[model samples]
Target: ASFSHSQYEATISWPQIVAALANNLYLGPQLGIDEDSGYPIFNADPGRLFTPLTRAEYDSIAQRTVYHPQSQSDTLAFTFSNLDLFQLPAGAAGFAGVVEYGYQSYDLKPDPLATQYYYYSWKDSDGSGSRNRWAAAGELRMPLLDSLSLSVAGRYDDYRFAGNSADKFTYSAGIEWRPLESLLVRSSYGTAFRAPDLHYVYSGVGNDETGGTDYYRCRTEEPDEDLTDCSYSDEGLIRTRSGNRALGPETSTSWTAGFVFSPRENFDVSIDYFNIDMRNQVQDLSTDRLLQLEANCRIGSDVNGNPVDVSSPSCIDAIARINRLANGNLYGITVNPVNVARERTSGVDLSAHYRLATGIGDFRFSGNYTWTREHLFQQYTGDADVDEFQVNSGFDIPRNKASASVSWEKNAWTVTLHGDRLGRLPNSDSYDQIVDTEAGEEAWIGATYRYNLSTEYRFNERMRLSFAVTNLFDKMPPKDPSYPSSPYYDGSWFDSMGRSYYVQLTTRFGGGPL
Candidate 1:
């Protein structure tokens, strides 16, 4: 049996810039217009037409710019294992069981100024909520034959939160066969359930400033401009988010089959294929996707000016989430978490390892590769499936990813080298529409690879020193101006840091002495 507790707290603050205050209803009139341009002129100088805030007032409001949010969790679990039910020629049948209980809670408290929108910050919602969960599981392994084994497990989970409750049962079964001393085969099928996370289910309404091209706004304001080559920059757009208490658990079914081949000692190769289908995936729509949906609903067209179904449920939700100003300008967007129809993916994984010992040192080489066969996603029941590999489909995941490493160990020193690679990806999903435009040059960012090197020295049984360098060759992410976002690269897939180095010394001492 075990018990554990965890807690997290954060105090966040945002700058109350003069420009933001100038846009406030109470101050916009006081700050007069520019005499020459006839537009609102922002000036800090007191004698100018614009009236600026006093230093004292600025200081007073700065003190009220902080908000605090905190979360805590307590968990307890009990388990019983190593109970042999019977004996077989190969081994004894083993069984195990476990039970777990947990409680989690969170509180989001915004500052008075923020709650009242006294500054640039939006009026954030405030609330506190909690949940309780219980789980039980059992597993059994049986060696029915000398060359084969089978195992099965089952689990049940129940969750209660915010006047709502959900329960799920999951199960898995597997089999393994060793037909020859050098080869082994295995296969498994399983089902899983994931309850809504504490923060995802209980977080209060909040707003953030994000950037995305408002397609509807762009087309409405610039009817004569060519949108294909348009680099319409839209920044500091508001995105509001809030949690949902009625969310159900996400569930998945998965299966895998694999085999391991070991013709000799210290060397092995393994290959596996796996597929998973999930339902009721809980997630929040990204800013770009949300805006695109809104445009499709309002303008009845896609980015390429193609007609789309505007009467669908997805379109209805999209239109409702977007708020507009008096002049039909975009005011903000709401992106609450909701359950999507389904997501499915299948892939194959290959791994190989070899070890060699020589008079001077021991060397180990290993490599792994993954090939994604398919990835399908549907946001709603009638929505079309989105293929991840298709260009301009909004999912830019490459089909292949791989890593390889080599390590050598000598008397007291160990050195290692490793490399990671990702297959080519289309520069942007909107590349086709802009192919004839000026921003379109490279259609794809070729396969990218990065390397790392590390060395370690052991001074004694208890002391060691190590040094490492990442991106050993100082590789840079390929430039793609056609991509919509700034920095011209996928920040999610690449790091802007050119090269990094680190060194460390570690020592271990007994409780009695150093």
Candidate 2:
């Protein structure tokens, strides 16, 4: 059995706690666990495992303890996962359950990214906000109709935000049927949701700072406790913390229908169509939309043909910062949101596999492909550009992406090959949604290979491993300088982490069972 337990309390200023207990804050020699709060505090910077702290010891962070360091945005998130089973009754199905709980409490911060200088000093009471969620679910599998199997799962979550709480329900049902020796059909449907994160609702102005300009944000929304009145702005866009007390959870409904065909052990194929529709999608107001709303809110010509104001500039500016309203035309280019809208996402998953045994002794190979077409079914109508992928033509989708892998295994040796092939699809930016046409990037292929040998004897297990490379064919990412540049985004999307290779050894201890 595996079990875990955690005890955490919200401390408004954890940085101060670290400062107060650099070496040993509690238990007379042990660090952290203040006399009253009894919580752990870190004073040192935890250097990256992959990226070591490049700079030499600096006076500013000298007191930071390597073992324990304070996070800019403090959080106490707990995760617990475990699985145990009751042997199924030989001819009867059995049951199992899973449970999880998470909690986080953070302090208020102001002008986080330096995006805006000093608007309303983001303020909060010590430990004024917290989040707690619990999920419990059970599953039961019952054999049916000789070659058919059925399973049902149900789950529920209880959430608390800013002292207020609510409940959410989700469930799933699935059925697998084999009508013939070579064919099988499967179907399932479920409900899903996304709760506003402490980061999204309460962590006001964060890394919203952009270099060339005053602000850099994922969405064009002003930072504030209320999300309705902000806009994404450059000159005046200031960073303020976000904290919404009454926001509800975003919701969605989804389903999948698929079929499989396997005539022989060497060949198997499957196709699945999946759909997901979400309501009240949590997204930032785009600078473009904010500007339109500020100047004129003409969503898509009204039912009756007439010029309509896209958004209210005055209304958008009042919620977050006062400094951003300086320019009249600025609102045309800026965006922010205190009361943003909702969005939707839907797509399909397609795949097939073929395996073969060759002269290489028990050679094994396989491949899979997926096609997803998404769209924006947001609260507002000006989502034309938002739904870029021409996928469904609705804005929130991406051209489909596919991936496949093949491998061979015999005795103690295993060799595998794989690659990701992005379809030459359209982009969110240009008149030509086709990736190959736009300068953003073109669909390219990347492949890799791994060879490993393993043998076990006595109480010891070991293996030798080597890797071929990424983009096996030296398939470089697409780069077209002709693509235009925008003040907010340059077309310099990161190329794939170029091809790479490595080798290593693996070891394992002998187990009690044989």
Candidate 3:
């Protein structure tokens, strides 16, 4: 039996904001007029305007600035194993089994003064805010035959928050067969579950200033007007995202089968086919969907203009009146995260590795490639499934990706070269409203390739040095006009930081605490 415990804490600071406010530099309200061109400030561009604020105005804003925020987490675990207690028949008597239990707690504490700044979206707590969860797992391995082995595992988790609890059970099984001295085949099937993260489950209420057409107002303006162009303007909509205590866990099932071949002593290759089907996927009710629902309700029709019941669960859930103007106009709508979607994806992964020795050095090469055949999603159980394969739609998952690396080592010196490729992704179809709005175009995202190089040297056994250059050729990411505010590139899958170099040194010493 074994046991362990750990604790961690971090402090976050916004030095730039503090410095700007202290120096009375362009951190306050915009000027009423341009000082240089003598023009009325229709839209004061902060980048071009360096106007300073009055002493009182600067102090007022500075008082609300948050200099520091803190986050902390704690974990404890215990494990037991009895595999060495028994022996099996044949040469495969190395059976093993293990069981473990663990608990973790996370807390986020923001400065009280920061909560006064509405623009910061700063979260506030009356006390020590924390989230906790517990997990237990067990695994067993056994050799069923001279050339065959089997394993099974299971896990259970419980998320506890205040007076609410969410739990789930997941399991998996696997088998391996060695039909030949140089070949091996393996397969596994598994089930998994995920609870929504704290940010999605426990965010504070805040207004998000955004630009989009309001479908409800548009429908009422011109009965036959195109929904896309009506009331299309930047609006400060009151948005609230809070923890859903009743939220359930997202569940999924996955299976994979593959074979490994080593026809040569120093060369090997493997290929695997994998498929994953997920249900009860946790996601926020998109604002676009909410607007669409409101439009349908006003028109007494569905997305297809078919007459439908307005009081249905889908419609009622989307139609929320969170805020209203003094004139009794609807001011804001509520959108919350819920378990409502399903996803299914299938793909194949191929990899190869080879090693050889020469007089000057030893060389090693490795490569891996993945091809996504299908990526389908259904918003709700009653909705039709849409294939997003090869399309940068909802999640922007690419259809294909690959990487290769070569390394040479001689004496105490080593060098390596690596390359990565991301296949081109097609824009979502016009019918896919979510993607159309987010990406802004129905064109393909150009393919991108990047390279990296690194070198390492060792001085004796206790010290070593390394240097690396990422994006060695300074390759830029493909342009996406839709993301002009975000450096014109998708940071999720592409490198936004151009060429960069890094150097590091490592040392180890054998001694007592000193």
Best by lDDT: 1
List the lowest-lDDT window of 10 residues for candidate 2: 64-73
All candidates: CA RMSD in angstroms? Answer: 5.7, 13.5, 7.0
lDDT of 3 by residue, 1-514 (tens): 5566666666665522343344344434545777896755544356735666676756554543343333455556666666654455633333334444445445555555544343343334322335677778888777777788888888888877656677888999999999997999999999998876666566555444333335556556654644333443223455555555566778999999999999999999999999999998888766544665566665777434567457655655556533546753456766667886788999999999999999989999999999999989776666546566523223466789999999999999999999999987643222223344456445567678899999999887878899999999998878774442435566567666779999999887864321
lDDT, candidate 1, residue 240? Answer: 88
Judge candidate 1 against the unseen true structure and give its global Cα lDDT, from 0 to 1: 0.80
Provide the TM-score for each candidate, comma-separated. Answer: 0.79, 0.59, 0.73
Candidate 2 lDDT over residue span 1-514, tens digit each: 2234444433232221122232332223445567676676555434322343333412322331111112222223333323323333334565667676666555443213222322122222111356777777777776656678777888788888766776878888899999998999999988876677664565433323221121222122332311122242223332323445566677778888889999886788888888876666656544433333232232322212335443534333422332343442222132223333545555667667776666765655555666666654434434322454543121332356666676676655666667666555332233212343464453222222322222222322343444455555554455433222232222233255555665555554554432
Candidate that would win on TM-score: 1
Model 2 residue runs over 4 Å out of place are 4-91, 103-130, 206-247, 292-327, 331-342, 345-347, 380-396, 424-477, 480-514
Which order, best to worst by lDDT?
1, 3, 2
* Residue 159 lDDT (model 3): 77
- Which 10-residue window of candidate 3 scores lowest in summed lDDT? 427-436
Q: Who is ahead in lDDT, 1 or 3?
A: 1
Candidates 2 and 3, the one with greater lDDT:
3
TM-score winner between candidates 2 and 3: 3
Runs in model 1 deviating more than 4 A are 9-70, 106-128, 216-228, 231-236, 298-307, 325-328, 409-417, 428-441, 450-480, 483-491, 494-514
